[model samples]
Target: MTRKILHVDMDAFYASVEQRDNPDYKGRPVIVGGPPDSRGVVCAASYEARKFGVRSAMPCSQAARLCPSGIFVTPRFEAYRKVSSRIREIFLEYTDLVEMLSLDEAFLDVTENKKNIPYASQVAKEIREKIFEETRLTASAGVSINKFLAKVATDQNKPDGMTIVRPDQVEKFIESLDVGVFPGIGKVTLKKMHALGIRNGKDLKDKSLEMLDQSFGKSGRWFYAVCRGLDDRPVEPYRERKSLGAESTFPKDLENSEEILRELADIAEELERRLLKKPFPGKTITLKVKFSDFTQKTRSLTEDYTYIDKNELYRIGSKLLGEFLLGSGKSVFPIRLLGLSLSHPESSSKITTVNTEEEDDLFPSLF
Candidate 1:
């Protein structure tokens, strides 16, 4: 049976939410994330801001320079989370086979939908409409026979658009697509593909599987299949989360032990709040540090049991920090970023205890 997939992406999610809540922000450029003067990056840029070439993951400083009149807003995760929950609720009304890619996007397999919708495109339309009717925010959707094509269709016409690729049209759609537009094809990989004269799906499809594997390894196999519109991956609703963590990048690097410890205390406090909200019982604590030169190191210690207290998290984080200092001979100091995570959960049974939080446990930043 052919699987009918729909990918729904909230347009400029953070910035859009800010605009929806603030009447003054309407029709104006809004940037959400860190302050422009800080070492923060753009989490989301409004359509108005995107006209100035501001984009998510770009430095906030650069975003400010690109659109000097843009309004910079700190991320209010709680508000975004509420909106995300509502969006997920709308998705569930259509199909239980919903795979949330992030707080702002999800993939739904509506082949056997709760609504018993005949066409996936009509389901996409209704979902988008219901989302806007409930939240006053817009979403773009892509409907196709598989996840890859659906995701690609979502981006073809973004920020309040819908694109559908029928089974018969999938071949032409894949053949004409630029390789860079495919997921996981980053700049470095694009350059490699360019070196091999693989500019689009047509070029990619010309390569033999053996040649692709020899060039790009496992991802080569993925490209080979996706180029032919043969993605067989299902929309998994119950994906396992491997870790839960948070990190902060400072405006300036910290040099002394006192400053480092102080920063870790703040991070531990943040992690504690997250754990309390979505209690994941894990036996491991990992500390990650990145230097001003971009070099990074991670230290992890897994205990026999899970950490349930805030003080314990701080203690373990401090211990890891000390170990990193001693092990690196203080060479990794003047750190620009610090992060902490808890992993190796006690069991899948423990996951059921986590309430209100999404399934994915990587970090807060989806992009």
Candidate 2:
């Protein structure tokens, strides 16, 4: 069946919430993260900040350099979560097939909506309006025949805008679509594709499956299909979150063992903060490392206890990194990325609701 899909994305959600709550922050570049002098990374950046080259996951120091007058605010996830719940309720009025990707975005299969809306774009428009009316926040939406198209369309006209990708326009649309704009293609891959003279969907489609396989390995088939506007991935409403993690790719490759360990320590620390906030309580702590050559290695250690301790996690992660560095037999130093994750959720720990302030107001800034 040609399903009707909608990708609804909140506009600079956390930063937007901060702006909404504090009118003074409204038109300014609001960045949600630690102070500028700290070694913390930016969690979110408003569109205003984007103009100054500030972006999420960028170091606060760099963001400060980019946008000197940017207002930095600590994240209030609980506040954002409340707003998200209100928006989700508005969505359920139209359809039950809602798949949330995060607190700020979701995929909605409105092929057979509860409201029985015939046109997907109308459903998208109504949903966006309802979200704004209820939460006092703007959301952008994309309506299309499939999930991939719908998702890409969501970014076309962003920050309270809607874009529809009709089935008839899919071919022409895909022809000029930039490979870099595709979700899964990272900076390195985009550079490689550019080197191969494959800049857009048409260029990508020109390659043989064998060529893609030789270049991207098993991911070649996926690239081949998506470049042709073909994606059969289904949006499952009850998709379980298997893990929670934090990772950072360095602007330049890190070669020193101390530098790699230092980055891993920071990643571990960030993971702990996220764990306390998300409360997944998984027993497994995993360390994932990527080399300068783009090869990846992962080491996992499962603890008997359900909850993770910050010290214990960093210890294990550092040890894991040390083991990889010694065992890989690479005399020279370059590690491209460092990641840490908590997985294999605790059997007894179902996600608890945050009703009262004492219950889940975990952020110090909120207090």
Candidate 3:
């Protein structure tokens, strides 16, 4: 029997929450992030803002430049998380095989769902309707026999779109797709593929296994499978976040040292909230920055201790930001994006295991 999977993604989740709570924000370009003066990046942009080319992870300052009249506000995760919880509650009503990809997205296995919906397309539609009725927010749903195709279907339509791919159509659909559209094909891979004259899925399908293996190592096998429209990965019920982070890009490149530090503080605060709730015992605190030309760099400091407190983590992040910003020799370009992440140490493996089991079993209803 063919399996069924559904991918549900909330449209403009953070910005939508802000618009929902504030009557004045309706129909306006709203950006949820820090102030432009603080070297802020766009955390999320409303559809109105998106019309002007503003996007999440873009610089808040640049977003304002795109739509000068847009309203820029800091993110309120407490409010957003409450909305996320409501959305998750809706997913559980259908299936026990619910896997949350993030607060705003998830995968549902309805092949044996409690609601007994036989057609996966019908299940997708119901999830979309329920999200709208309960949350007053729009969502996009994708229905297919596997995770890969389902995710692809979800993106086919945007701002509340639904797409369904039957089992038989999978191979044909993949054959016509662009290589860059495949998941895990990053900038580096795109460059390498271009050099090899492999432009799309059809080009990829022509490669021999030995050739692909030589180029991508173990990943070559996975790439070969994708070309044949084969994915056996299950709809994971729970995914413990390996890291929790918040990042923002600047509107204009930021050469200002003071502004960069301020944005880091804001990202640190958001990361802190996630850490406190999840109790990340990891020893690594990583800082990610992207330059104006999209060059990215990451710096990390690992400690022997796990941190649950917000203040201590913030201090360390601030210190790291200073170290990077106050370089003696080279002049730094304007900052485009800043990110902060906290990873627990390996020593906490036992605790992490316990937490994972508890989250999956004890709170199965929460998925």
Give candidate 3's whole-model lDDT.
0.72
Tens-place lDDT per residue, model 1, 54-100, is: 97766688898999999999989899999999999999998999998
Which one wins by TM-score: 1 or 2?
2
Candidate 1 minimal-lDDT segment of 10 residues: 350-359
Ranking by TM-score: 2, 1, 3
In candidate 2, what are the lDDT values of residues 1-367, reduced to their tens digit?
7989999999988889999999999999999988999877777889999999997767788999999999999989799889888888888898888998778889999999998889999999998888888778899998888788898898889989999989889888888888887765645456668878999999999999988765654457778887788887787889876777766556568876766777666666666655543456577766766666776666667777866555667888786676556554441447766667777834332322211212111111100
- What number of clashing residue pairs does each candidate have, in the order they appear? 0, 1, 14
Best by lDDT: 1
Clashes of 1: 0
- RMSD of candidates 1 onward, in order: 10.2, 9.2, 10.1
lDDT over C-alpha atoms for residue 327 of model 1: 51
lDDT per residue, candidate 3, 86-179, as tens digits? 9889899999889887678888899998888778888888888998998899999889988888887787788899988887888778878877
Top candidate (TM-score): 2
